[model samples]
Target: MKLQEKKELLKKTVYEMFPDAETELYHNNEFQLLIAILMSAQATDKQVNIINRNFFEFLKTPEDGLNLGVEEITEFISSVSFFNNKAKNIFKTCEILVAKHNSLPPKTIDELTELAGVGIKTAKVFLSVTEGAPYLWVDTHVHRVLNRIWIVKAKTPLGTDKIASKIFNAQDLAKLHDTLVLFGRYHCIARKPKCKTCPMLPWCSYKEKNLD
Candidate 1:
């Protein structure tokens, strides 16, 4: 099949499978969402949500982050990986948001990346979730699913991200942002994908599909 045809099939199948696909991270606002995404680097959404349950109650805005400070923030998120660095960066990010951005997250990728701990991927995720922007910030699940579906054949998530940007249009990126993540996370899993029951099984290009 053609690339567009394959993409259409993939999108259709995933959308049907997970019509309500969205970020699993729990957050009350954009600021909290950004922090959650930042902490989710080497952690899972479940882990981040567990931490944020109490953390978000105490840390709501940039001023709140400043009030908690790096030490307190570290204590709050001690269970997360790289807690010390994440705390410091969160504090610094809050400082910038308060001082320059008037305590609001930036909309553009360039402006968002200027914040501490916010990289291209984080920025894209933040914008996509908060602003409905067209961005498919490829993480491990996304990278694995895209490769399995033969959408992109890159080695690393970063490489797949580059190719995806070049091939997929803005609308496709926006639409697939949540759906693809959910599909990969739940359906086309890394070690044990539900290949036998998957609707895309016929068209899927994965060689070692877990049919068992």
Candidate 2:
């Protein structure tokens, strides 16, 4: 299949399989969502959700993060990777959101990335989910999936992210990130993809497919 054809198939299959595809990170508001995305860096959704399930109960706004302080935030999310740095960033992010954006996450990538700990990917994902922005945000799963399917020949997620922005259509870009993330996470996994049962195997270009 051609690149566009494969993209269509992948998009259709993933959307059909996961009609309600969205970020698995647990959060009730954009503030919490931004914080969660910040924390999710170098971490997994399952791990992030494990901590946020209870942590977010009291953390409803920037004032809540400010009230808790970095030390308290660190203590709250100490179980995950880079908790120390994440704590400082989250606290400062809340500060910026409160001081400048009125405790609301900015919709534009530039304004969103102004917050501490929010890189381009995090800002894009937050905007994509909250505002339905059509940005092709790429993570490890998305990068790997795209590369394995011969969609992009890049060594890094950022490289693939740049290429994917133009490869996919604007109308489908909003749904592509989450749906592809689900497919890559659950089916076309890094270690042992279910190639034998995968419907995308015919179109997959990976040389080392696991049939067993």
Put down candidate 2 lDDT per residue, 76-162, tens digits, no spaces: 999999999999998999899889998888889899888898888888888889878998788899999999989888999989988
What are the models' TM-scores? 0.97, 0.95
Model 2 alpha-carbon miss at residue 111, Å:
1.4
The superposed Cα distance between candidate 1 and the true structure at residue 72, in angstroms, equals 0.6
Task: Please list all clashing residue pairs in model 2, or write none if there are none.
Answer: none
| lDDT values, one for every candidate | 0.91, 0.90
Give one digit per residue, the lDDT tens place, for model 1 in 1-212: 78899888888898898888779999999999999999999999999999999999999999999998899999999999999999999999999999999999989989999999999889999888887798888889999998988989999999999998888888778768899999888888878999999887888898898888
For candidate 1, the C-alpha RMSD (Å) to the true structure equals 1.0
Point out where model 2 deviates above 4 Å.
none
